[model samples]
Target: MVKEAGLGAMEKPNHKHVADSDLISPAKKAKKSEEAGCDTEDPKIPSGAEDEKQEISGGEEAIAAVGDRAAEEESSSCVSEEKKGFLIEAAAAEDRGGRQTMEDVWVVLPDASLDFPGKLRCAHFAIYDGHGGRLAAEYAKKHLHLNVLTAGLPRELMDVKVAKKAILEGGWKDGATAVCVWIVDQKVFVANIGDAKAVLARSSSASELGNHTEASCNPLKAIVLTREHKAIYPQERSRIQKSGGAVSSNGRLQGRLEVSRAFGDRQFKKFGVTATPDIHAFELTERENFMILGCDGLWEVFGTSDAVGFVQKLLKEGLSVSTISRRLVKEAAKERHCKDNCTAIVIVFKRE
Candidate 1:
């Protein structure tokens, strides 16, 4: 695991637009549209599309009707995406008895060439490690991308340091930990917030496909961003004790909670940098292949390097990427009969 000194307190992202609660209503949509300028209902204007109407004479009645229709379309589109490869797999076996809910999110961006060229076209991947509850993990999955985008495109490429700064200052939860990876230009930028890890698995040789036995896969030179917030690191322990907390017999703090850097644990924020994410960025080499973004659930079963190897074997055996991810959780639960939720996300990088 990577280790580092405290980077100090990170400012929370602005939630001025997001309401205190979760529920979203259709009426809210119409009001927003009306504010944006949807006045006229000209036939020549595109139907079922957002049109800039010059003037709308109708009052609440017309706005409500238009908004209701838009809301229905939006809801339908959401359901369709959920049905696709956007998989949310959870083996309830573990979550039943533990504090971990195993709520994680993953998004795969399709390779588009307008932005970059060459073999660099790659998929984006992320994994959030939540503890104390699934709130942090869930929050990270939902907002980590917005943090990166807001961080300002890292200029010619993704800057992990800048992204991490954005995350810390970007308004993610107080104790949540996150790891995100995306491809920019011809290079791969991987950033971590807490303990969640990202690893690249490379195939031995596709050109010599005829001779390789079982297709060897190895962990490529990679970067670890989010460091574990634990007592093993002297500085972390110091930060914890200084902040009025004590180390536990289990090597974790206070009988629970590992790693000192997290996004949303308000309790730990009093200790300063002990509660922020450590962001690291690195460019990948040709040997760098598929990458894995997983939580402590999978790590509980496999080492960072070993997990990558297991995934490689699964792929060689013709297991689908999603299947391998699900199996990672399944096998982990089966091995230890764990009550901690097991979750994982795997990204397979292919040449374009």
Candidate 2:
């Protein structure tokens, strides 16, 4: 049997409290990253910044401080902590017997931003889908934030693609799809891989908006995140078949690669199938309400709109993200009629 990621109950604080125990200064939260037990490391900075390194104490302290000030400035400058009204909740459940030893992993980035006081103006979130095993998913969970926080990614991800190519060509196991969202320069960029999905909800009614707007129904729009690498998409399927791999049931080449793009799965390269992620970047209006990061287990059962609706209802009833995550998994387990491991992280975005 595969060793599961343990089932110990996650600690959550009551939502009604002003002082949540989970609430810690951003610096302390960053330090906890090193202790998350997944060999997940701190965000990497650019080379030749030795002068900046000297400005700080230990290397670990430098990393712990990277995004700490960002959180504070955003709080004192943009929003007030007392009026801050957004919540992020996450949950994971594991079942050992199904689908390659249950290697799926999920994480919620530290809630340092809760310090922002204005009407919860920004939300950052991510979802990773693991394949071939859970290592790739776990790797992304640990590294995605660091990558974003890291000083210099080529503005176009040209370096990201180049590095990925080098890693795969050298025969690395990069088989997870990642979808990440962060608010910068007043717009939202959602980047993705594999089939893991990120969804946005727009208020549909004045009632839904808590009387914030006069519009009768707020619209829910899907801000597309990562593109899939399965062979089923016509262009991708054609590429696989043309490359000499057989397209099997449902138009997927080789019957197994359901997505047209992915982060790992090196064996597919023989047919010239490269494990590259298709990143989608876009802006969402400030009215955007909520976002969800879930594995295919949820997608296999819920439509994009259906999920947004379900979560919106839950939030209206005063549920936290952690509660939402648990319910989503429970719902999937029920619908699938199996002991499938399900994990989810949800971010509820609100106006201050």
Candidate 3:
């Protein structure tokens, strides 16, 4: 029975603002990395200089849901252990580091059952990094997920059209990069833009976090789930040049913004910055131990494998999920001297 990360209710604001989605992208909303003062390309981004906005934004709502973790941990229902084992626990943490403003926002939705009224099990997590400003990041942290819900998220399968449409309809301003995850039953869907990234800790063999000896034999494998959209990539460069934008030698759009895609920056909209997200869906299996979502600042100091190993060691030592996330931020800001806002989310699959 693991403690789940449910920061609070997925409360929508009273205001009807028909706008926003960041922290991640596609043509849906290319969340440009803004936290590293650039795009997710920097970790120093979501990549480049302070002039380059690096924003990580995350907002999640449950279009569907199953049961909560506390209930599962305390229940004696007929649900088999194998079925119960798929329930998830999550947590998030943040650090400002040396940045003048903290521009990363994130959300955790353990079960959307209360809002959606469903028997299906679902969970969501997201993170955002803002570059020029934090407004864009903050906005996405509240509305993007709700928009996805309203757009009709498919329960049995991921309707790319439906999901992508949700993001497309989600209007945004300013700039930020996003990374998000939605879990429905055993299916996992990941959506992202910029440098904010999602990584999965997988194992070739069943390795209990409680058993280091066994865990060592079946070391967790780090699998990066998001792709960074910067001005330097050939694909992005092609688009930028076609859009009449130039990628300077330093690898920034117009010698100013480094991320080729973003939520806002209407100024760059004509130049190639977009907010569309790259979405992926896959099955969750016993081989997956946990997942991680982080803004560029955190990645600036931690490699995917290094982060997985660190979290695995701590899980074996029985550290709290919140603590693990906090440590990730603190380590990046204090120990590794990351120069931007650091934010992270940790989601662990129940193995019991």
| Order of candidate numbers by TM-score, starting with the best | 3, 2, 1
TM-score preference between candidates 1 and 2, better one: 2
Instruction: State the weakest 10-residue window (summed lDDT) of model 3.
Output: 64-73
The predictions' CA RMSDs to the true structure, in order, are 18.2, 16.0, 11.2
All candidates in order of lDDT, best leading? 3, 2, 1
The global C-alpha lDDT for each of the candidates, from Candidate 1 onward, is 0.41, 0.41, 0.59
Better of 1 and 3 by lDDT: 3
TM-score to native of every candidate shown: 0.58, 0.59, 0.73
* Model 3: per-residue Cα lDDT at residue 254: 78
On TM-score, the stronger of 2 and 3 is: 3
Off by over 4 Å in 2: 1-100, 110-124, 151-173, 204-226, 242-244, 335-340
Task: Please give the range of 10 consecutive residues that has the lowest summed lDDT in model 2.
Answer: 68-77
Q: lDDT tens string, model 2, 197-267?
A: 66655553324443223322343544334344456666667777778887666554465455555544444
Better of 1 and 2 by lDDT: 2
Q: Cα RMSD (Å) between model 1 and the true structure?
A: 18.2
